[model samples]
Target: MIDLSSARLSRRGFLILGTVSASALILPPFLTAEATAANRYQPFSSRLSLTINGRQRQLDVDTRTTLLDTLRENLGLTGTKKGCDHGQCGACTVIVDDQRINSCLTLAVMHEGASITTIEGLGTPDALHPLQAAFIKHDGYQCGYCTPGQICSAVAVMKEIKAGVPSHASSSLIDAPTFEPREIRERISGNICRCGAYPNIIDAITEVAEASA
Candidate 1:
């Protein structure tokens, strides 16, 4: 008894009805499949080989797994922190093939034959990297989650500066990248310190840089 001609459906109403109709049309076969096939589908896996902390490693990982998960779950290098897993926070930063990267944004299978360095590789109880010692000396550890990534990024940042890679500070300052505090700040901006230890962190990096220079 509904009057089709009298039904003045607005654009929003039309879209809603269309969506319902499309879902009704498409969802039956998808939902009716065996529960194992539909719900328990396994992601494809690939064999990956990479060097970690100066040790060779081989693992079979699900294609969907990120390098961060591979390090934490499979190879068990847990120093790399995971925050804002979409690559925004830079907490899961690690050095890959001599360059720093957000491990959460990259799949493990993509880095076959690559070299990775985590915070565990940096130092030990007796021996410490200069940056690590500087971090400790300058009181740079606050809550300690971001320190690993911060240190890793700092190590790579200094190397990048030494290699003449321009900092975000300015084009005119490219030649003297390591000498300025602003250049170091701009370079390590991607690594965030939620505990607000930035002043001491900068102090540590500056001391390390000065000592090395």
Candidate 2:
């Protein structure tokens, strides 16, 4: 003999309330799992063993780090400038396994067992490498931000020429390329100096090339 009218809800209201209650009961675990996953902090790092500057070094770095960042941040090798990190400016150039590459564009993990040579590796303040000396002798740089990459690239360019690698500016495609000004310019074109020091750079590179020859 209870009042059924007071206890009864509209069919739509009943359905909506039941559904909401069911959702509330079922959603906590899912929401909690998602929140836990979001809050989880797992450091992602890798062990890298590489020869840097003629010294064998081991480092534990985050997998997402780039070679340039590792060199600049972890190893304190800031001589390699990071300009136009898109790899277009070639300011982060470094020699890896005898090949010059834009360090900014490469991951440190990829070169785990490779030999890396940065600007600091090429020479010291008192004992300068030939190219380092040549760059200074010819005033090859103005701002000097791009000088490190230029020097590294010039070293590789000389090696490439000596290895008989032909460039587009080479006079004869079948024959070995000559180390002329045009060839040097074309070879090291990837390394740009915004200060319009092309002539001086060319002069420095030519001096080094001739000396190496």
Candidate 3:
């Protein structure tokens, strides 16, 4: 048998319990909602102004958005393919400030006020860039999923060679890197072509390099 007589709570204890209960009930719903919203992950937007393909573009994008997503989803530049968003495949490659980067690996918010160029920026339907023309002439792409990245990387590779940038394949670190087949292959190793159009790609890049030289 329980001692019901001695189990009674004191007046002070009752008052404390009542106070807690009242607090829980009297709390405004909006306050609770605000607290919940604060704890939850919310998408924050940031204003971005960058030059894309020689045109100034301003957009409000989520801070977490990737550069690839900004170009494809926000800017409607779908030419930069998204293959292996993990940055393994170079389909998401783009040129930023004359440097080639995997757009999928970079956040859009990081490149504010920067100059960016995508595959579409490289050429038009009527007049093609030299690399693009060479790709078509040599059949550098089969499925063409990786063609944009390949062409972009190829353009950078030529620029790097012209600027005397030494690559790993270069024989002399101090001397300028030559546009040898091995050097070209080594430089573009990051780009993966599932259709195995490597030979044609190399040929196209080689043709462009020679013509520019």
Candidate 4:
């Protein structure tokens, strides 16, 4: 016969062993089931009001949806590119209250009452914004996937410069705040153009800076 008395563990040790066994049996199912249920649910449909492109727009959107998704999928504003769903790529950059931000990183629900300006709001074919026209003239883009974000970022960069925002490359020796190639490149480095059109993109910003001066 097994020596039950000799094999017996202390009450605390037995409790710990039983607790571990119970956790192993229940934890995995609870986590997996919760995640699966969350993924399967449709977007929460709630009417959201936002000011986009200087106009008030109202739409029903999922509370879990990102601002980029609401712009592209719900509002049909596809000018903001969705290069990477994550915030790593600046392709989804937009201006919110004069500050440039990645739309993909923000939720649509959070942008309520905020003024948002996307690529579509930047310029038109006939009256292109200086940055947009410069991009076209200097061939600042390649496959055109990152053009919108680049242009938007370029515009905001200028605004920042005009407001005396110093970049990491700023020289302490320089008497005046000169937005040279380094500053422009550093400011816009977040937006990656896979086609490798950095030179032309810099040139476009230079042209706009010159015109603005």
Candidate 5:
């Protein structure tokens, strides 16, 4: 290669080279069409269609959003509490396809086309579910924060017993789980009541179970 010092250089060629170098330094690589296409940004979001509380609903949510947030923030169904988002506490519990689950543990997009029911769907002020009424009679709504999850879980517990699903407290795995205090307590152990009102909660669930029976 000829040395630039020894080579004859036209004024226009040097000016053009200097201008191209400056443009490369000033402009971002992504500003180019090829760069933009190669580095396109894709949002982490998904559309979900769900039958919530007997109503058909559809919404778009971040793929990372939990079902608890979708219910409370997106759908305005705030009755499903968001305590201990790590899924240890059952405060974020809800019924999906007649089965109870911790809403905080699942992603909203994962339940597309699934039916869900929060505490608000159970009953209104005028018409209380048997469990809700029983809770009131038994004073089980101690602090009231964990009441939603407790009631939801209790509802599922009754269903599990009727469905003949065995639990750890059951006397035999082959037989249906008994609808007794020990079985009820075991089924609902995931729910925590900070108010330390376990006895009242158990009594309320027992009352509902007996009445339904």
Candidate 6:
């Protein structure tokens, strides 16, 4: 039994004001502990070198960063669009070691020593790549957001077909598929043109295929 008349806080008032009041006034260190832990999880500080766009580049980036994120956020190479973070859209496609892959699906750390070519490396104002010129001539794109991926995919498709990679339209079991519109469309079907430019896109692909052959 204690005296309550001269107490700083009344018994009833203290009971009404629970531990929440005290917690509101004072926070524990754990509030920011997770952020501190994340900061501590730094990537290897060693410099990484890779050839990009016919030029060698050295960069230091977080190990967890994806190639698409590194290109767009770190290097300011925004031509590789991010239509979908997942690999379904092919908007983030890039040529890695002469192969087209979804940049968004690959970690930058994985391509530390690989050669990478984005749409920026493909064409320039003076001489656009054949595929790029064809796309322009055929009006293959409307919004043009997916143009980079489309071109990269088209380039890789030609190389693959030349290498005898069979498509769904391949007629013979032993012989390589002919460079036909159906073959090109089937091979590049992974790349989705949201603008519904399939006809013009196919036209562009056919033009390049004919020129290549």
Candidate with top TM-score is 1
How badly does each model clash, as a count of residue pairs? 0, 0, 0, 0, 0, 0
**lDDT winner between candidates 1 and 2:** 2
TM-scores for all candidates: the values are 0.82, 0.80, 0.80, 0.77, 0.78, 0.80
Off by over 4 Å in 6: 1-40, 43-46, 168-175
Off by over 4 Å in 1: 1-40, 171-175
Per-residue lDDT of model 5, residues 98-204, tens digit only? 89999999999999999998999999999999999999999997679999999988988899888887676645433457768777888899999988889999999
lDDT of 6 by residue, 1-213 (tens): 777666679668797677768787666666678678877854565467888888888999878888999899978989999988899989999999989999999888888789999999999979899999999999999999999999999999999888887666545433556578877878788798999999999998898898888
Candidate 1 at 45: error in angstroms? Answer: 1.5
Per-residue alpha-carbon lDDT of model 2 for 122-183, expressed as tens digits?
98999999999999999999999999999999999999999987676645433556678878
| Model 5 lowest lDDT segment of ten | 168-177
TM-score, predicted candidate 3 vs. hidden true structure: 0.80
lDDT of each: 0.88, 0.92, 0.92, 0.89, 0.89, 0.87
What is the lDDT for 197 in model 3? 93
Model 1 — which ten-residue stretch has the worst lDDT? 170-179
lDDT of 4: 0.89
Candidate 4 backbone collisions, by pair: none
- Which is superior by lDDT, 3 or 4? 3
